[model samples]
Target: MTLKRLILSVIALAVIVFGLIVTGIWGPSGHNPAPEQQVQTTQTPPGMSRGEYVAKMSDCTACHTTEKDKPFAGGLGMPLPIGTLYSTNITPDKETGIGNYSLDDFKRVLREGVRKDGGHLYPAMPYTEYTKLSDNDIAAMYDYFMNSVQPVKQANRPNDIPALLSMRWPLAIWNWMFHEQGAYQTQQDKGAEWNRGAYLVQGSTHCGTCHTPRGVAMQTTANDETETGFLSGADLAGWHAFNISNDNANGLGDWSNDEIVQYLKTGSVAGKAQAAGPMAEAVENSFRFLTDDDLNAIAVYLRSVPAVSEGSTSRYAQGEAVAQDLQLRGLPIETTREEMPGEYLYMANCSTCHDADGSGSPDGYYPSVYHNSVVGSEKSGNLIQVVLHGVKRDTNDGEVFMPAFGQHLSDDQIATLVNFLTDTYGQGNAQVEPQDVAELRATAE
Candidate 1:
């Protein structure tokens, strides 16, 4: 054969091989559970089952349920830069949800990102991370959703992404480029606790879905411990998912293992930081219910994470007490001297709960603004969101609630309040613009 013909033949062969690999038509096959391993009909109800605990670990309700909808009935709108993609109903509604799915069908969706009818699921489901979940966990979850969840007749909301971006065919290519199929492999060198933590964080919990930054095409920059940006931080919706890394300044470097455990279990750590927005939801719905051993394992794994600095002061360094001044009270005498709108706003609206000195209750039930992770962080998104949406945490301890100020406070007022809080209690010069506030409000809505 001619040299050119031979080269052409080799190129064609290579292309065919690449195609097979990408489509999973070749290469090592994925795990296929035996028929007997399928979900049993007489399993525990989802509400009180071990599978319920597994679902909480997955935090399924956070995405699948909307504010007004029944849990797992879906319709939660996930706003993306491209467009809005509503979450699918995972409830066992045969027509609108996964009710008709068999064990293999559910497994395929979770591990391969394919639906019961052979449709591609968007990456928003975090199947990339779910793919790593163990077969047992998958079976348990299947049982819970299928047997326990009440089916709602609500139809799935259609995504508003542009046609070019919404097509499922391209996702096949995207999956090939970004996804890794299979269950999580336990690292031989790591202890059992660390391995378990790694599985929970990387597989079931999918913590990196929010905490890790995204690259082009909006895929998480890191999926596991190997990448530099893993759990470094990411902006989600209107909130900033703070760096959970060990960076002494911008990350959790100064957080003790116990502190991490406390934060996960209770969503607050006295003067350090309190969970808000998505993190708060996770705590309320998922983490708070986890076993002490599981929480400790997570803490150990997180504490071992390498730090990724972003040139900011540590939470330890930033929590110095601010001097109490009458000016912070918006008293007539103090208000007449300076035209600080933010100070007045804070005094009038925030001081009663956060305190005039910006120190929360002495017990840390109301976390002090000073040394607070949200306030101290470089990103002002969470601070802005907390002000607009307010804060609420309910646990075994008690309920902590803050009323939403978005309806009452103007963009200018919020900007003023945020700027004042950051300058006074946190790292100064974290200026927030009125326009920024307006945008955040819209996003939150």
Candidate 2:
């Protein structure tokens, strides 16, 4: 063999390999094709009609629409560590919403966190998790939004993030580093129900968007089952998204499958947890409408997860019955008001519905303060907010209402009541202060 021939062959091979790598001719396995190349404009999958069910499952309206706004006419402000960011209109309005976005554009936004104009979208949209959505599901959602949803003319509100942080270009870098772009793959060993649950929770539904804890950069710590924080819970806005993990103490350990199903379906489960704040909105707009089978699947998947404990007693263990007779009479004498204001306030305002012993109404409509997830949570935000704003849920049985005390009670009074409720019926002292109540009240206003 001639040395010249061997050298020429090696040079040719190196040039071919370099070209392949530069042009991405030999890409890694499982790489999603470019949005333009992957467009699917055909009709939705069989049996999927308007994609309304998928929208309901995803809880689209929860963050997109305000109480006074039309559905999908996004203006809801989501408060983050950096600033308040308003959701964009997703209705089919071309001027203000996504009416002009093609299926490819929509898929790009969901899968790559990039917009029609190639602008990067903030992670606040939960596209990190939505990246796992199947093409069929994304098509259905696109069809529903474009064809079924009503278009609104409302313009998007500008985000309140500071000048430096408001820049969208950095998000592209962030997505490149942290986001996983592809369709969800099923686990070979898990059952169909488990996989379905995983698809719903991890993909379209994106439950971990709120439940999972975030890192210092305000990015979610984990999005899948591989991370311990998956569904383990975190603080959102001012409300504590209590752990949904199977941990006996901190999570849903004591909850039966039926109880979890009931809670998701009805937004409340007798003496156990009742959805409130953001959770209540999710249930009202989304979970309540989910099929029974999906709800059961969620329960099953949650049960299978390993528990993440926070070293607290289970909800079942914390609620000790208080003596009825110990309930305070009329407001305490002025001399002792400073010392036992909570007792006096509870007796006057709360006990009428909650009962003197903190045991709620017999039908569990009022919900016992004891064994109540809000009261027992390590954070007292939900309890304080509920007191200030009240709670209302309409179910098959009837509408349940807790009157708002913010108008009547001073910040001190609400703080006092929260402390009393937590101390009596909960595990740890709420440690809520009047200033905290004042802050929450101001935000609500």
Candidate 3:
């Protein structure tokens, strides 16, 4: 044989080997589930309502529903580094949705990130954490999707990613590197309540997907409470998911277990905190509907999460009322409004609802900015986001509405107002500039 022929053969072999290593073409995938789980999938759960409850526990509506009229006909645009990925239609429509997916197929999709057609779904579905759901829960969820949900006929949209990047094969490599597929294993040392809470937070809720920091690959840096980074708080996409762990100042360390329960149940805890953004949505759709036992369990588990202090400042301890009202009162006799724009903005726009002292109204319907987690946090992103976007959270009680000033106020004006809030009622650490407001405003847009 010629030397050139042998050299070409070796080159081809090297390329093939490289491809195999990178893509893990030979590796096992979403088809695998434990023997017991497989058997449990076949059996009927005690009640159909449990299925709906499980669906809510998974917070399926948050990602899968965009329009109010069309729930679970998923078309939410999830932003990726290279491109945008649109969620698939999960409604039970035969033509465009998962109408034909069998129980086993649903199980594979939920736990393994494999679609019914044997294609890989991006980790945006949170299958890595969904893998921890019990077999009964998976079965119940399947039942809910199949029988309870009203099927919508919307066609699935193609992702905006590039052709080569869109190939499913590369995901095999990603899965091998990042995915941890399995069901929850109960801790013998912990009580039933703690275990239940752990299962809910780590499994269905997938709290780490937001609260935990991510690696370069966008996989959560930590999967469970055993890791210090798990739920340690992450600031991303212009919003900060504050630490839900037991760290003081930054986290819930100073919060009583009952306070945690109240926060989850109502989306507000008077002077302490109030939910806004995605968290407000979570409260409106999922957490507020949780059963008392489950709420208590979650509180118990969060209380037990080891303290992970990020800084010396106790966020809740910072700031006092700076008498902005007095400044506003003397405004006519003193310098022009241009001199104190921050104070002026607060008094004119905010004081009616939030009060001159930044203290909430009598009924606690409007929450205080002072001694509040959102305003006092080190990052100040949430406060900025709230000011730009406004707050609208609804529960069985009623709706809490704060109108958006994004259109009315300029970037500099928004920054001025937020800096005033932080200085007068919060830590005064957030010396927000107009650029900060502009950047975060762009993301929201």
Candidate 4:
């Protein structure tokens, strides 16, 4: 053959090879559980309120709804690394929602992470962890969504992304590398409650979706509580969800089992912490309804897990010992003069309840801002929302609620208090713009 013809042939071959590599056709196919293998749907026998309870425990509404106007209709704008993902309508609206999803279809999506049409769901759905749920649990979730949830008429908007990046097929490869299949394994050595807790947190609840660290590929670097990194917390949409592991400095090692249950139940425990952002929703809709045994199970499971460090990234660390000592050395005033502006505003408005130092007294009362992670986070979205929209933590043991504060705190004051708290403790660098606070304030109304 002529040199020119041979050169053209080589170019064509190179193009084909490059395409294969980019598309990951050369790699082992990712594990996508077969349709039947993934989810098993059976008729709900009588007296099985397990489905309804499971739905509440999963807290599906957090993503599936925007405001309370349309429940499970799914138009919430979920921010992503690439852009924004609009939640799909899960209501049984045949025209616009998942009304047509059969029991098996729902199960497949939940257990296998595939949509009704075989498209892989974005890991944003957390099916990688959900896939650990048993066939019975998937069926329970399906029954709850299909039979119980009120059908809202809402059309899901297409995901806001260019077609190139919106490609769902590539996720098949992602799943293969990171996703695992099968039901949660019962830990024989551990108690039944602990194993049950493991299944709920690691599987249906998919707590790791927010709490676990992500790899460069953006998948959960570690999937199980067995790994120290698992449930250690992750940053989502600029907000850092604090570590849930047993790390003394950053994780929950210091928090007692009762405190964990209390926080999950009531949103805040007296001197400890309060729920904020997506976690508030999880508490309000899900954990508050958990059975005492289940809450205890979760606490026990969390306590039993190993502490894995995802990396050297430190948000909570050894504070300057001398600085904390100096702050403590001073007879703590009710609130300092400069800090009093924010304090006075809070008193006139929030003090009848939250008290002066942002400490909610009377044991398990309003949230304490001192040393609280939500106040300390670099991202002010959750903190801003709490100030602007007030949050009730959760109702696991019983309901403990915080009223909305948006009407009371002006944008400047909110910004001032945020600055004061961050400066005093927390990651001191956090700053909120009046403009951003105003924007969020608009949403509160």
Candidate 5:
């Protein structure tokens, strides 16, 4: 090979690589819909009037509006890698909202992640999930936004990302790699209930947002049961989103379908896992409103899912060993009156505010330990902090805060109270230790 020929070969290889990268054919495509293509209204169903129900299922209002504003007028701002992205106003205001959007235009955006003007929507909208909705669902959603939602005149703020991050063309390429660009297909072999559940979880509700694992690109690795890892639990903002698959280890393989339905309907579905963080939002705003049929369908679908074998073992699996070690370490297994200084400690410090039942104010002021799920999780870190360093609950109508108790309660007392709460209300997981309290306090500090 001559030196000139080698140089030409290198140049050709570089050009080929660049071409593949630019064209987005180097990897699986992401969900990227052109704005104009997405907003086309010609595909709307002949007649659909149940738009309100569809809108509720979609939970558009939760992300689209801030607490103080009109629903879907678009003021919620979500954090992104580069910068924050504000929600867009979806009201039918001709000037600042979707008033100009025809049914086809609305359909295009929701169905394809494209706007009427031919711009691509950011993935933050969960279009990757929404694209799986049936065309009927898309039409119903369009009607709901158009006719049912109240219109407010509001302008969408420009994205906070720099030009490099905000560039839509690159996202178009990214979408080409990852986005699934069609409505969900009902499995021919599945029952109607299972299909309904699958559609709900995979499409409008996007259960995978919390359950699915993510790749380096920050998108859910895969959206359905065909992927063994789907719903196999992944770490979220700060906490772990528990696996929802039928895996016997970390997932819900042990939970009965009824328990799942009950948990979804109410915040408390004892002995099983409870909702918290963003999941709390999902429960309060969305799941709580689902029809009994829908809830059952969800349960049925989840139960029918084939279980996956998880290589990552759960800490609870080694409970017997952990318990023996705790005893060896002189961690008290039984709470004598002397060891349980928390009883007196609670009377002196917390009785006035929290009450003897461990139930705080019922008006949703202070969290009630009698019913609070946080005190009941396997991990007591959050509960220890709540007792040691009190927290202020975010109230809608007023300002109220839980005072910090670290100044008053010793590590032992904090541990005892947490243990009491866990034994009383929490599931029968392992007991917490004073060392655990100290570690949690230090971390919070």
Candidate 6:
């Protein structure tokens, strides 16, 4: 071919690639901001009553709200590979929030990941999961936020991603490639309750955001329960979102329906597991408030999912409270920080709440270290996190607070204590090191 012909061919390829990248710009470049309107009605609206519950179910507070005083006036900064992305103000503040958004605009934001200005939202919004939300739920959410929530005039914080890498056009390609549009499809074989549970879990609650593994592109590997590895767990920051699938050993397989409901209701179920880290937040804000029927539905759906076990022994089945060494009991109570052995560390610090026998309180407030999934899991990340940061799960039962040992204990001491707990009451394979604790502590907020 002639040089001129070769140049023309290259230009054609460039045009195709550019077209693909800019495709989002060509589509419904959203409307100008709608004027703020006062909506007053004496009559009860269709979804007004259900609005708050749906918002709780969606767990919007976890990401959108940073300050207690400024609930939906979003400014929660989530760090990314590129940079930090701050959440937008979702409250109905006319100056700096979604106050001017129409119901249609709101729907588009959730379903299409598009804003009123036609810009695409990063998947951090979880619009992929929000796409499965029904029209009614979306309407209810809008109503709740616009009416009930107190809006502030706080401006949305700008992201810190590099200018060249921060271009929005490329996200169009990502959306096209990965976004699952439309509401969730109902399975014919599943019962009504199960379907309801599936709808909430797979759609609004966005459980898979944490539990489901991600692909190289930072997209969820599975969108729904039908797919393999859905809710099979993933690592977040430093904590691991435990497998919530029906897996007997690692997931919720051994949990009865009542036990699942109980766990969701109170953040702890007898002997199986207790919520901590992000899961605790989820339980406190979202799961605890769900209606009995909805909670039961979640239980049913969770139990029905295909088991994805890696080990035969249930995580809840492993571990005993047998004492290793009160031989260290011979040591002085005021042992030096550097000199305290693992068992000695537990006796000094942990044994008060967890008890000398590793069994929790008589009322089961402080959970038994034995028969606990956090202890039993092979990845000791959660165990390490709990040790460093402590557990803060506030349910109806009242605040459950475990004092963080991060400031008080050395990295070496934490590693030793966690290993002792796992070996005595969990799977005995934990090999946490001082470096691991230091690294995780460095990342802790």
Per-candidate alpha-carbon RMSD to the true structure? 6.8, 10.0, 6.2, 8.0, 9.3, 7.0
lDDT of 3 at 360: 72
Q: Where's the lowest-lDDT run of ten residues in candidate 6?
A: 34-43
Model 2 over residues 1-445: C-alpha lDDT tens digits? 2446534644564566557768877443335744443222222234557377777778878778775448889988877656788999999999999998999999889888888988898888888888877787788889999998889899999988877557676565456446778877767688878877777788877889989998755678877777777888887777778788888878887789899889888888876788777787788777877777778778878877678888866654566668543644453467346667767777678888888888878988778888787887777888899999898776656666889899999998888889888888887667888999988887773
The lDDT, on a scale of 0 to 1, for candidate 6 is 0.81
Q: Would you estimate the TM-scores of all the predictions?
A: 0.87, 0.85, 0.89, 0.74, 0.69, 0.88
Q: TM-score: which is higher, 1 or 6? A: 6
Candidate 6 residue 15 Cα shift, in angstroms, is 12
Native-to-model Cα distance after best TM-score fit, residue 7 in candidate 1, in Å:
31
Top candidate, metric TM-score: 3
Positional deviation of 195 in candidate 2, in angstroms?
Answer: 0.2
| Global Cα lDDT for candidate 5 | 0.65
Encode model 5's per-residue lDDT on 194-222: one tens digit a residue. 78888888877788887788875577897
Instruction: Give lDDT tens digits, candidate 3, residues 249-293.
Output: 668888888888888888889768888998998889888877877
What do the candidate models score in CA lDDT, each in turn? 0.78, 0.77, 0.80, 0.68, 0.65, 0.81
Candidate 4 achieves a global lDDT of 0.68
Candidate 6, position 34, lDDT: 21
Q: Please give, for residues 1-445, the per-residue lDDT of candidate 6 as tens digits.
A: 3446544644564565568668844333223222221111112224537778778888999998899888988988998866899999998998899989999999899988999999999999998888877777788889998999998999989999877667777677667667767766667677777888888788888989999999856899998777899999899989899888998777888778899889888889767888899999999988888877778888888886777777676777777776534456565656633465777788778888888888888899888999888888888988899988899988887898999988899998888988878888887989989999999998887
Backbone clash total for model 5 is: 23
